[model samples]
Target: MNIQITPLTEDTIPGFHHVLEEIVREQKYLPITEAPPLDTLRTQLLEQLRHHLQHFVAMVDGVVVGWIDIKPKLSLPYRHVGTLGMGVLPAWRNQGLGQALVQLALKAAAELGLNRIELQVFEDNAPAIAFYQKLGFEIEGKFRRHARVGEQYRDALGMARLLEIAH
Candidate 1:
């Protein structure tokens, strides 16, 4: 399949949301098991873009198959850091799409003047943990019983990567 990674725009929101909904309903990853309203999602995406948050999407044959985003802290003390979020469709999981997205995020973080990027992944998700490790992220801490899904609690690992940027 032909895959392309590009910065997300308003035109791509619908397709991006479709992939997110499918991935969320899989109930295997991500905190949101259900997608929010379309307009709301679109507005969120646009708002993020307006605020120096960078978002990129991986499209396979014109359909969004994965996405990565980073939101930088704005305060003086924490402005050098950014938080990351990303996912790939089930069918696209093992084919390097996720890694590619992370690479893009790292570059975007540097462009945004962020010196470090961090992420949180559900600890029970072993593959995700390993994947983040492979991408130069190190586990910094664990959020025990971070969230309740039904009766059980899920733990998340806080991982981060330090970037060398030319200031």
Candidate 2:
């Protein structure tokens, strides 16, 4: 399967909405709500794209199968840091699409002058944690009882990847 990464554009909004909704629906361990209406999602996505973030779509066979977005933290102290988020369709997972999306995000972050990238994953999502770790992310912290999934409280693991570490 040939996978291609392209910059997200207004024309691809519908495809993005479809892929996002499908991914959210198939997520078993993570808490993901149904995506907003298409119009709302389009507006929100355009607004975000206009900001300091970059969004990319992963396409296979002319269909959008995944997406990744990264934005630099705006706080003065965190100006060099970027946060990344990604989602892949259920049928597209385990085919290295997730890793490809993340690598694209990292490249965008580096181009934007970000020295670090961070993300939060639920502790129970072992596969995600392993994926991030395989990409050189290190667990930096944890939030106990951070989110409620159903009746149980779940912990969140904070992970970060430093683009350049001073020796």
State the RMSD for candidate 2: 2.2
Question: What's each prediction's TM-score?
Answer: 0.96, 0.90
State the lDDT of candidate 1 residue by residue for 44-143, as single tens digits: 8898789898899999999999999999888899999999988788889898888889998899889778989999989989989999899899999999
Per-residue lDDT, model 1, residue 139, is 98
Deviation (Å) of 158 in candidate 1: 0.6
RMSD vs true structure, all candidates? 1.1, 2.2
The TM-score leader among the candidates is 1
